[model samples]
Target: MTLTLDGEKIDRNRFTGAKVENATFHNCDFSGADLTGSEFIGCTFYDRDSRLGCRFSRAQLKDASFKSCDLSMTDFRNVSALSIEIRECRAQGADFRGASFMNMITSRSWFCSAYITKSNLSYANFSKVVLEKCELWENRWNGAQILGANFSGSDLSGGEFASFDWRAADFTHCDLTNSELGELDVRNVDLQGVKLDSEQASQLMERLGILVIG
Candidate 1:
């Protein structure tokens, strides 16, 4: 079934297996909506609204702005987006594998236990965000700002985090195997009680004060 939402206020609607392609939503509100198993390809969501359990697979969201919305458990795997603003949203348990986010502002968002594997998160701002137990494998986070964020128990293997500021961020128990940590500020961040390998610990000790004598 094909659904088109154009300049309408649709609240609390449960749509499953619905195809909404190339539609434009202007100032439409979708608060408290259950859009599970719905596909939105090449759609543009303009304005602020909350969406719960919005399942999307192979959807294209170019130039979509999800500002100030609660998108908890929104599955957006293999989606491509440009200039998306997901600011101040609760995105816990959201899946974003192979998703591309260009010039996105996801600041102050809650991404607790979210899965973001092989995603492009370049030029994104994550200030004061919480990403506990999130999976961020092989993601591109170049030139991102992650000040005062919580990344405990998160998997960051093979991720590119070049030139990012991690001041006052908590990375306790997070995996950093083969992840790029270049140009990151380790002085303001706390790495105490973090699970690190011998090579990772040696690299961190070079920046932080750790006396090692054999």
Candidate 2:
């Protein structure tokens, strides 16, 4: 059974195991609410101001899509989010550690200081997202869309960016050791103080059409 809520005031309601589809909520407060095993498909949680976004602390959001929602300071720790789409949300300081997602797309969002360590993010698309100072180590970002994203001051070891477009991202002071950079395109991407492996350096030189003479 699925529940549809539109233009309603659902402040702090327990929506465990609930299926919300095509709903639009405004000025609703979901702070400290437990949405364990809940699925929100094509839902919109809109809040005009950036100071106070919708809160989903420790909510179980598996296989869901939160479109155009403001999740600033939203606690997403240890939540299972498989095949989720958190589109265009402000997730500053959002804790995503220990949470696993597959084929996920978190596009057009500001997720600064998002603790996303030791998680599986393979086949994920985080393109055009502002991920400044985000904790993204030991995670699987292989074949992920990280273009035009800000990864400044973050440790990105053990992640693979094979076939990733680096034309518009900022990697200033980022640690890229032990990471895979398969055929990286470093056009317009900031790489100051970034440690690259031997293969990564070769790929950049090869893109520049510069061959080393013996």
Q: How do the residues 162-203 of candidate 2 rate in per-residue lDDT, one tens digit apiece?
A: 556656467888878777776566666668888777766776
lDDT per residue, candidate 1, 12-127, as tens digits? Answer: 44433355665655444454344434455545443345433444445545444453343444555655544333443444445555454433347544334344565556655455
* For every candidate, C-alpha RMSD to the true structure in Å: 11.3, 11.5
Q: After superposition, how far is residue 180 of candidate 1 from its true place, in Å?
A: 1.2
Tell me the spans in candidate 2 whose CA falls farther than 4 Å from its real position.
Answer: 1-111, 206-214
Evaluate all candidate structures by whole-model CA lDDT and list the values in order. 0.56, 0.56
Give stretches of model 1 more than 4 Å off. 1-11, 14-31, 36-112, 185-187, 195-214
Clash count for candidate 1 is 0
